[model samples]
Target: MTTATRSTGDDERSAGNDDRPAGRAGARGVLSAYLALTKPRVIELLLITTIPAMFLAERGIPSLLLVLVTLVGGAMAAGSANTLNCVADSDIDAVMDRTKSRPLVSYRVPRTHALVFGVVLSVASFAVLWAGANLLAAALALSATLFYVFIYTLVLKRRTSQNIVWGGAAGCMPVLVGWAAVSGTVEWPAVVMFAVVFLWTPPHFWSLAMKYRADYERAGVPMLPVVATPRQVSARILVYTWATVASTLLLIPVTSWIYVGCAVVIGAAFLVMAQRLHQGVRRGRGVNPMRLFHLSNSYLSVLFLALAVDAAIGLPVLG
Candidate 1:
């Protein structure tokens, strides 16, 4: 779901590096435009959480082929949802400084073509997941796509400041899809990991939103930072950051000292950074939200990587 525009959805900003107009360029340029529509970096972040869930479910390495299939299907599902968001949000994207380079806004590709591409990817994701994994996995992947497109993009985004909080649940579905791919059902440990990402989404996006508060304000999007004070926003980030760390510990029942050790250290760093941001905002000193923004990305990456490694080495703390 990228916080659900990452379209996390961190506005799923454009994959293209610069805002230079594409202007219906050649085949390679056209191809790149389509790729940008998928929001590859955000998809990459979503998948980072996915594989570790599979590892945790299997309690070790899953079949490499299963990992491959799930990643492909999950990427397609996320891609379809993100592309459709581009079509729906192109108006605000054109107005927003952070998103002006996106494919739909830039006219590098036709809107109708991007829409078709999105729908096709969803269908393909279902087929691939159904055939290669289980129907449950396929269904969960499709549901995430539908929720992100219909609920988050169309319904809640412009209407509420708490938009990303609820909308980000769609982004958490990859963990469900991953766990279901291996075990064929959702379990509590999987649910805890889902909670971690769900909680992680807000602070992650809001930090970036702090960096681009004016863009959101200009587009009339009621992002928390746009509507709330910097201190208020950072306070909320601290709350979510604390909850994210607590959720990581919930995996304690299923994980070993390895995972526990990593979670504690990384989570401490997350809190330190978050607290620093909060203190800075409170004091009206120079606060770089982007520092926490970049750190949050690395934090989730390291947390999930530790989970995968803990699963791989087969060191469980409990039965």
Candidate 2:
């Protein structure tokens, strides 16, 4: 899901409906506006990491009902974070072309309502996880929401070029939530999965930042591409891409050759794409960093899917 290459944690996707309506039309428009606030696409990306983590922890399929409940809790948690992020970033959203139409910027939704809604969603996520999954999962889910809202949105986002690097930790919590849901604790494999997402976040986000460099510059967000040269940005992307691929291989001790084979083929593709991006940036010819951005999404999804599939098949390389 990379998203929620889904979002950079700094900038969320904006989908806004027109305002200036009243009656039933107003009600529908408001509903749609609220939905956009949640960043549903971002939630889906987080979920992609989640269920697979469950599979790996279970070493096979987990209970269907448990999966269903965890998904609900996780989605609500992600939504809470995204909604609060919109509230916090509305000022910049108004400035960035891509986010100008966001509900908050467009006045389709009120900041106060969005704030209350975000809080409600967080509470609901905690209640759902605690009742349906476990306390550990619930606590982790709520902690992720808080981190995204407080640390990413309020603390680092506008102040640093490295915002996404540290902020991306919130996104990695789903793996912990998933693993804890299954095994009731975090273990080495879960941390390995977390590292994969943590390493992957910057490249995925920076590519988009490169594509939207002017928007961030105008908004004064200090994203790496807005603050650094293209060559430097692409260089770091290559380094993180290398780390991402290596992190995937860290699971080899607990996974089968099938996982290893998938990692090799797909990791090669990821590195090759990142290298091309670097070379293109270095050469000064027009470069399409977005190619690597889109591939980052697929790279994370496929890597985690391999984790799930290898676990479900019960084939082990070590022991």
Candidate 3:
């Protein structure tokens, strides 16, 4: 009897050990789904604009602790907005090939879980920003979230072809938040930065819309490319691209020569790409919209990186 009991106990322990890996995998899947709901790539772009805004606000490296706090809070706020967007768009996402693999579309995560997670993150974001930065920063972050969820996701997206144009306002809020975190007030430079992002958004997103034209059409979402010809969309993209470059130049009066040099060089490269895109679409060449789309990503990233670098090391022309 004693020998039989020992063998059974050993078998139970072996089974328990075998279940451990499965448990770990399950945990990992849940974490991954939650992260996916946050739209991390978009969050990354938001942060790219954010940290540099802080640098520009201070005209140098801001306090390390303050930067950390603001980033953590900002990330949470963006994540919350994205998660709610996922929830709201899950129906269209399921039908669109590009978004079909999203966590909500795939049913990997339930709606309730995603909703709760977003709310929790939003509350946490407000708490962190208020505690670490200021009430103004916290308010700005929350306003961005509300604008994205209510205006962009709910009203404008389904109602108009100009959805992304107006919807892009939410994305610009990060600069304000970063600036407020540093100076506790919105100022002229911050407004210029906001305009740069706002002007940049139409072209950047329209390029993506051009790439996913069919996807948007299938989902009945009237992205610019869905409602207009590629040539028309490309032309508008070029217009926005030029406006974005001009907006960046607006900062030169307040910034350093390094920033001005970068703005001119980077703006030239961006215009070259945009002009090529326009020429190709107009001529009926099979130009991949993703080429311009990818370039836009680099354009914004490098431009902001120049901003941060100039803030830290370059001499100011105005001062």
Best by TM-score: 3
Clashing pairs in 2: 2-5, 3-6, 4-7
- Candidate 3 lDDT over residue span 1-319, tens digit each: 4545678778888789989998999999999999999999999999999988999889889999999999999999999999999999999999999999999989899999999999999999999999999999999999999999999999999989999999999999999999999999999999999999999999999999998999999999999999998889999999999999988988877678888888899899999999999999888898887888898889999999899888888485654
Compose the digit string of candidate 1's lDDT tens values, residues 1-319: 4333354223324535223344445666888999999999999999999999999999999999999999999999999999999999999999998899999888898999999999999999999999999999999999999999999999999999999999999999999999999999999999999999999999999999999999999999999998999999999999999999998998988889999999999999999999999999899899999999999999999999999999999974753
Candidate 2: which stretches are off by over 4 Å? 1-25
Error of 2 at 49 (Å): 0.3
Q: How many residue pairs clash in each candidate?
A: 13, 3, 0
> Candidate 3: where is the Cα deviation over 4 Å?
1-15
State the TM-score for model 2.
0.91
> What tens digits encode model 2's per-residue C-alpha lDDT throughout 72-186?
9999999999999999999999999999999999999999999999999999999999999999999999999999989999999999999999999999999999999999999
Q: Which ten residues in a row have the lowest lDDT in candidate 2?
A: 12-21
Q: Which number leads on lDDT?
A: 1
Q: What is the C-alpha lDDT of each candidate?
A: 0.94, 0.93, 0.93
Q: Which ten residues in a row have the lowest lDDT in candidate 3?
A: 1-10
Error of 3 at 110 (Å): 0.9
Better of 1 and 3 by TM-score: 3
